[model samples]
Target: MGLAVIDKSLFRFDGVRQRMGLLALLSLLQALCIVGQAHGLARGLVEIWKLHAVSTLVGPAIEFLAFYALRHFCDVAKQRISSKYGKYVAGQIRPQLQEKIFRLGPQALASRGTGSTVTMLIDGLDQVKSYIEILLPKMTDMMIISLVILVGVWWQDWVSGLILLLMYPLIIFFMVILGLAARDRSNKQYAQFNILNTKFVDSILGLPTLKMLGVDKEYEGEIYSVSERFRKRTIDVLKVAMTSTFALDWFTTLGIAIMAVFLGLRLVNGTMPLFPAMFALIMAPDYFLPVRQFGDNYHATLDGKNALHDIMSFIDSPETPQDTETKWEGWKADSELKLEGIDFAYPVGSKPAGDDTQSVASHSVAMNAVEQQRENEDDKKSDDSSESKDDSKTDSKSRRHRGRGKKDAKPIEADADGKAVAAQALTQPDALHHVSMDFKGYGKIAVIGKSGAGKSTLVNLLAGFNTPHAGSIELDGNRLENFNVAAWQRHISYIPQTPYIFSGSIADNIRFYVSDASNDDVNAAAHEAGLDEWLGELTDGLDTLIGEGNRGISGGQAQRIALARVLLDKSREVLLFDEPTAHLDIETEYDLKKTLLPIMENHLVILATHRLHWLANVDQVLVLDEGQVVESGTPKELIGAGGPLDHLIGEMGGNQIDQYLN
Candidate 1:
């Protein structure tokens, strides 16, 4: 509500304070021009009242017009200075903010919804620019121009000066009160705007899923509801802005009217001359002009102030720690990774404890409701067994409490006596904890776990997408502080369940990791990834455009493209697959595996999956439950021993060899 305090930060921006000083000087000069114009006009009018010749008034009238022109020239100069500087500052901030966002990575971006981040970068910066451009000149004028005009009026006629001066505090009092109301309302409106943006983006992204479930109309209604709420909030802010404008206008007009009445009486009684009375009357309005303008522009600055705060907060957020100085040659066939007492948890969404948190929470609830409704409709259409399986997975994931509460809920442990007992107090709720493992000269090591059993978390940690809170990782006998090192990431190819197809030609997307790859190299990689036949079908072959807004490729084709990217980049010898085939149909999955298995022969592979069939291909198996490694060994050994892997194989509908054969 106290905008003045918040707005002070604008001065700290580079060149803003210096720009303010120059604008203030210009405002002072403009104020003098204003007084000269008023004086000239008053003289012309007084001469006319005395029944003087028209020729006699020409000089004074010309003087008035000249001063009026000069005053506007100053205004233009001030605007030009402020606007260019504002744009410069905006340009500087945007890139720095973007770089910070990139450094924070996808996990951070997910925590702060994509819609909100996009809005802050685009609309938010635009608002701040507008605020800076307008605020600097207006603020300078209010401080300097008003005082100059008031002094001029006092010099012409003291009584009129006293009356006009008395009105200043009264006008400001009402402005402050209304300004505070406007600020509060505008803040709420801005927050609502963020919600509307987030919901719109989410709805658009999920439109395909909504249509499939036949609940697109329900989501549309939800969007409309959010839009309506934003509209109402906007109206509330406008009402306060309008009231402030009205108050400032009323008080200034009242003060001018009083000054006019007093000067008329003095002139009638011969206590004041015609020239002085007219001059005083003409200058009264100019005295209040700057203050009135400031009040009118108050609402415009509110958004800018809020946006600056948001941008600053994002820039200050803690980034994932990286040891930039560490040098390692690269991953190799004999390279070994030893993770000792590894622990990790998804970071919680830390919202400020005020209206911001409440607003985001409310929007989150609405979004969740929409998602829940869609899920329910999907459930109705799904088979009973599939629904039961999905429900079980959901329960398991919920127990992990990823990004849920304030503290990390440590999973209870079992003692030697097999009694359930509390584990050591953990600082945060962990997605993976005490996950010690060793991988040397990896052929194919399969990390098997149900949903919420920390499979993806472990993969993310390995790929440097996440950093462990407490752990030591030694790669190739060198003590590694964290996995997110640039040198380490360069040697890894991460293939997720759904691979991202960047907007470009087929060859370009395939050659993403190896930008310098030749056409021959791309063709060879595509052939290996099983995309050669698909490319032949296209008119442009390797050059065929794909991705958003281009030719829509099939899901199988997208996966192949991701594989092609990995294949083209020969520097990357380490492959990390996080259930790349989980979403494919059984036939498609089987076909892709035929292409995938052959490529894994020489590379060090760490594949996280729930599919039982992949176990046959993996040389070693690591079974995880509740973030801990429960059992690990060769598939034949685990099966012969009849332990955790055997039980999991039964849960996955028996041995996959029989299913494959059938």
Candidate 2:
């Protein structure tokens, strides 16, 4: 909090600059009204019978416009600040978060679910606008308002102003107490709602695998449990919020009652003038107006503060050095690449990737998804093993047993805390630990690892999504930190295992990785990635709409489109593949490898794969175990060593040896 307060003080953050400017103008108008009206009314009341009540019209006009302008200013300021600061906070936080997640690499991304992060980043960040724009500005406005209120009261009558000001400390004190109570309940409600969001995201992502396993019915139970908890907590928050409204109503009623008593006593004795006393009575309730709303709006502000808490949590999160440059004008200018001794551990209790409950739940769902995939692989392995054994030894009943095992062993893991905990491990499962290596951008290299290996993390790091914890990673020999994040992004032609598509035409997606790409360039890229064959079949060709999230495209088609995007980005000096052939059939994989190799040969091609046979044709192979590079050399050299490759090959069986050598 001390740090946060200090940071805020230093920032001069212009979240509500435009609105503040407007608010200042509005405050000036109000000040003139408050100052002018009091004198106008006083003068008119004194000389009323002499000049036909001229002060009545002038004084009322000032009062009406003063109130109107003051309220309007506050309203506009709140809205404007909310919009601007909300966007400002989102824009700054999103990329940093995405980059953080990206750094965790494929292993990290895959271990988590997507739905939660998407929902949190989209909706959760927005809820915080009340604080970033409204409460923060209002807090400042309150200070100035208090000063103005005291000054106006003093000008009218030092005695009345002193009485109001002296008594206000108690009112402010009670308000603070009310605010504290509201904040406590509101924070709990916010935390529970986030949990519910995480659970919902988990439910959605795991729906497919759950359906396959005939456990779809269970989702309702899970969702219901979360919803019930959320609903109850929301009610609790609302009850506390309403408590403030009660206090406000009471204060207004009591304040007016007190004014009546004071006026009655003063009027009977003729100790005070009629107009001044009346004006003071009217202004008494006005003193507590902001307080009334403060009590009611305090809960909203509490929500805002929680949202701010989440955002600040992200910004304050320990960051791996960021790769912010969009275009690496000239990396490796000193040397091609360099890496120092690397050692890293997950930062504990730290938001490893600044992912909220949504992202964490998404990860949980994604991990659960792995269960189905693993089951399938195990089944295939069993089938192949059974087939290789003599036909006489085969039990037809065994196939059903194998299918059941696959069903039970499904790929994705659903225990929410399981993935959350796993994601926190910097070196969980097959992550690299103390190993380090570097190379220039002129050649292709393969990073090979089986299921739990950190190949994906390594890929993300090279792709500039992450920062190394202990060792320095450099591009073109310049320290990674010194590199601009946005600029370095331009250095890679990236092709994901599962491709992404926008809700636009086929042409739009292909052109995503390139700017102002001509028809010829698009067509050329499509053929290079072998997407033209599919395009030739489409009547609309490049203009065909792909729908949101690639709704219309088959999995293979999506991968192919992604490949075409890789080709289109001629500006990128490096190409990265994360199990590019992981999903393709052998025949298709072979064809893709055949086409992909040549295009990537001239650039830096870093491939992370589990398929051993593919390495036979590659120039270099990097074998990962835990999180370290256990073995790295030419594939031939490693195969001769009878090391990690031999182990992976032995598990794959003899067919790989013969097929790969041939």
Candidate 3:
């Protein structure tokens, strides 16, 4: 609609400008051939009307046929050139978009939504390709061919030329008005389509849960409703587009009728010759042809224009701040990490005036409740945080977990009417607030917390998936701005409750962290992880293929595969476990602990869990309540001191003492 959406930078895509120039030249030549064909046909018709000799008509007929063939050849060449250039541009953009998506990481993708991102990469790019191919040659033809035909008509008869020229602006004025309407409607339709796609994908991904809950039928009905809404929106946009096309056709046809009438009147009055009147009549439609076709194709290109806008917006999005200049060696046995006054809060949506803090606080509370519920549910399964598996589902949930650590001072505020206001506070909260901790050398430290107590948030921050908004971190006596630094992450192994099983052989999954590991090394790591018995039972043994959409494996087996990965990568000295055995049954947990205890020796291990039995093996315990460390000491000292750790053990039924003894 508006030329602004065309994006001038698109012309710079590879060889677009060069190809467009070439096409324009071809179009100009084609315009000349069109004029020649019209003139020759007019001359032949005039000769026939005059009863001229057959030989005279033969020359004009041959000339007309030759020009017609030339015009079509030029058209074919323009199409071929434009099509190649379109494909090249699309190929170039697809990879760049994918790379950007990767660099932006799960945080960005979660904000953008998975369905929308996938649609942009696949369907959006395709629409852009089609737009580029059709628009280039069409634009050039409108610019070059239309003017040439107009001048040719003027040469034959000025009256016809003047009439066609005046109608140009009239057609354009109507096109712009109708084009804007179509653009508005089309944009709305596209937005609805994206919403439909997002809902569909979310439903499909959660289909298993829906079926388990017996709500699959309800979800299906909702999907159908959304689809119907999208269909209706599409029809609305088409109606406007078709109306615009009809208007353009009407104006062009009216202009042609007027030209023919004028020419006939002039010829009857003996002011114009037969050949000239006929030639002008023939060229009138050709003169207006380019603009009319452009108007018709305008709606077709609207999707591409919007798609280009979406792609450019994504490419231009600001990336999370990362420090790339830091230099340091990997973590070691004596490496120390300290956090001082660390503060963080989940980012909130834009709010209206006078409601900013209140809105954010309420949203934060709602989000935290939802996150706690999800984490509790997920803890019942496996705690795998791999991008290929859980990132799509958990990324959004995790964002809500990033909130201020301070407990809400005013849990409920009252309005003048004595009715409780949902959220009425000025202070903002952080997921971790003024929290300080010290970890040094090789030993096991357990971080214990209830749901929404910032356990996962701390893990995410340490894994470099999130950055603290305040305070500083020190690693091995070197002060660091953030944990996202590459030098530090390379030496760390993070194993969640559920480890992701990649689509590959059992041996390949074992060697994930160390791709060049020999068969002996793989077998040794698997033995350490207690996977030897399972592998022995398999017909293919180490060569067994398993993962999503492949051979099914138990949660315990997946955790063992993850353990093997850590065992294979001996260079890693720092291990972070977020409830690695939370999803396992009691027997499986006991077995996993036997394997994990040996690996925890002589390594800096930080295990966050609700399982109180872990306290028996840990050297130091850091107890967290509402996101702050309430107690820190050796497990023996904190166990029966009636402190936060003691309270937590009591809440878990106090039977953990016997379990720990066993």
Candidate 4:
């Protein structure tokens, strides 16, 4: 908290500093009163205290402005600082954290607990707000008070001043030892908290699955265990803190005892004047009081340190530099895109650079099984020679065809359409191989690939969320590197997989990007997104409140609301949709897309989706294998290739292409 306060607070010659100086002056006068009494100058000290106390009282009123400066002006400074820089330093940091898991891609998510990640992102980060805002300010105040203490003690009695100065190291030494043990415990607690949060979120998200698996609800037990563990560890942290404070208190008592002993000897031997000695000894502890309080307040700083470890570690994880001089231009306009030797891989050295298409070996058995079933009937008919021969000819044709030999399979290149894209990267992963691509004449383009194929990476590039290494991606002839980030963003709308709902009405949510958009304009956008129907169902209609997380709304409804928001952004050239309807039902998905297509005309709509059925009408479909584009064309053209994509379509569609076509 102390560090953050120092980092954020602009200490100036102005209000807060001046106010602190006044407060210290008041303390100094009080010190003089004690000294004057000890030295038999009581009448003079009394006159000084009366004269100073009035100004001391008024000093705090003037200091209020400085406190306001700390709170509000500091926020303004952050804005001014970021504007000279690119915005989204905070927003960009989060995606890097989530996307790191993404670059580790499917494997990371699969192995790690989802509930834990959710806790870190949502609750854990939120918890840090207090430490940053409140505790930090208090810490600064404490430090100032400590300085006042040292000054007051030094002026009155050099020996006592020396003792006050020595108090900090003695206190801090013990606190440091306690802090070391506390930090280890804090780390363990954070890990446990993540696990508990992960479990809770998973239990909620997959409740149906859990119930289906006949798992008796163990939430109470789980909560109890988590609470108990957190309580134990939190207590340990607090105990160390309290113990440190008590140690500081003990030293403070000893210092007072030493001062009393020295003062008693001086008085008895008449080496020191009685009033002066009495006043100085009494004021000595008061001088060092703030030091004790500082030691007591050390826990706030410790908590803040831990919070920083999490915040800074996660925020700095992105490979995207906020202020890179590098610029990109001349790539895709809308859905038109081109790739020139673009290769990307996970930061780690586990996977080879390849397209997202599946391997032939992966689908061969299933294709052969279907072929054998088709050929079985004719094999028993001795009289059906021509039919059997025709079947044999068909079989040979099927075998000759590459890929899983499944109906309408594009190729092995579409191993599968994986989730997560560059748009989602809060930070780019380290060592992202020289990824480069070019796209032009963009439109309703379908971005498809298997899990971990870098679909999200592509979307982020298009959205200008990240800059590729050793390569360039352009939108509307302006490479991501060259586009006016603010203006280009204004012209491009993005609907993320996880849509955010502000604390306002549905109208506010839709008009979030366009602050001045009229209610009618908001309604029109809702209509285009197929949210009109849902809005009409509510009494508030467009004004319906959408609490955080869209608490009462269905997932599909929330998705539609997000789509409505993009429409309201009034983007001219492009709209990036990251799984707009992944959580929607087929009926809602069909109706929503049906309404959405016309509005998407003229503007490029690049969507990443796992379900290829809704993607049939897209202008161009790029099937990625790992990180390379191995097969790309219209749905028909790709299916004609007959490989990874086709086999996947068959298996994913229950082995019948017609299953989804309807």
Best by lDDT: 1
TM-score of each: 0.76, 0.67, 0.71, 0.61
- Candidates in descending lDDT order: 1, 3, 2, 4
Residue-wise C-alpha lDDT for candidate 4, range 549-636, written one tens digit per residue: 6787887788777777777775446777777776677887887778778877777778877677755678777765444555676666
Q: Which stretches of candidate 1 lie over 4 Å from their true place?
A: 1-12, 199-229, 353-428, 442-451, 490-625, 629-662
Predicted candidate 3 versus true structure: per-residue lDDT over 1-662, tens digit per residue: 33534766586577777887799899999999999999899999999999989999888999999999999999999888878877888888877886676444444434444566667878889988888877888888888888998899888788889998999889889988888888877777777666666567666755655665556777688679878987988898889878987898899899999988998898899998998889988888888788777777787688887787778777765544455667767766667789877765544322211111122211221232334346666674433321211211222334444443435332212223211111211133455656789998889999887655667667766776555656668887767766766777778888865565667898998887789999999999999999989989999998998864224898788888899999999988889888888767999989989999999898888998888878889999888765567799888787777788778777777654944533
Give one digit per residue, the lDDT tens place, for model 1 in 578-619: 888877889989889999998887888999999888877889
Off by over 4 Å in 3: 8-16, 47-66, 206-225, 350-429, 441-456, 489-661
- 32 Cα displacement, candidate 1 (Å): 2.7
Candidate 2, residues 1-662, lDDT tens digits: the string is 11121124213345445655565555545544544555455445555644666646676566656655666665565567556765786677666655555554433333233443454555656755445555544544454555675677666555556666766666666667766666666666766666666666656755765777666676678678777976887887777767667766775666556656766787689887666665565566556555565555666666665665554554444433443543357433233766555533232322322223332321343233344445565674322211100001112223342222111211222134333433453322213355568776477788886654567666665665434444555665345542226666667766666665777988888897676899999999888888877888999998998876669987677777787787887767767787777767888788777777778766777888887766767778888765667788876677746788778667666334654543
Q: lDDT values of the candidates?
A: 0.74, 0.58, 0.72, 0.51
TM-score leader: 1
Worst 10-residue stretch by lDDT in candidate 4?
384-393
Q: How accurate is candidate 1 locally (lDDT)?
A: 0.74
Worst 10 residues of 2 by lDDT: 385-394
How displaced is residue 275 in candidate 2, in Å?
1.2
Clashes of each: 3, 39, 8, 73
Worst 10 residues of 1 by lDDT: 383-392
